[model samples]
Target: MTQIAINRPCPPRRRFGLSLLWDALSLHRQRRTLARLDTRALEDIGITREQAEAEAARPLWDAPEFWQK
Candidate 1:
């Protein structure tokens, strides 16, 4: 007798709206602008360059699906 593996459904691919892409890009731009600010300026906004970098590094698909509304 021959043994065969059972077929399985493929995992869904990640999808994103244009708005999500824009939001992530905007976040990146905001991070860059914030980084250019002096330390004191960043402190006034309650954010640091490290924090901004973290935000900018987030995936575009990470944006909320607010556009679905």
Candidate 2:
């Protein structure tokens, strides 16, 4: 006799929404940290303070393109 296999169900809407919210919050926190970093640390990371500030100024909804999927 042959046997059939079952696949897992897709994720629920609530989980996906929560995950997106959490990612946005995390990005906000990271940008806040970047904004708070000293000039020396920014230089060590190869970014100028102005650049860091510019990136940090972006809104939470401005996530990476890959994250859109």
Q: How many clashes in each candidate?
A: 0, 0
Worst 10 residues of 2 by lDDT: 9-18
Model 1, 1-69: lDDT tens digits are 999886997775554688557777786677567657777887898988788667656664555465344
Candidate 2 accuracy as lDDT: 0.87
The CA lDDT at 69 in model 2 is: 61
lDDT score of residue 8 within candidate 2 = 86
Number of residue pairs clashing in candidate 2, backbone atoms closer than 3 angstroms, sequence gap of 3 or more or interchain: 0
lDDT (CA) per prediction: 0.68, 0.87
Candidate 2 to truth, TM: 0.73
- Writing each residue's lDDT as its tens digit, candidate 2 over 1-69 gives 999786987674443677778988999999999999998999899999889999999988788887766
lDDT of 2 at 54: 93
Candidate 1, which segments miss by more than 4 Å at Cα? 1-15, 48-69
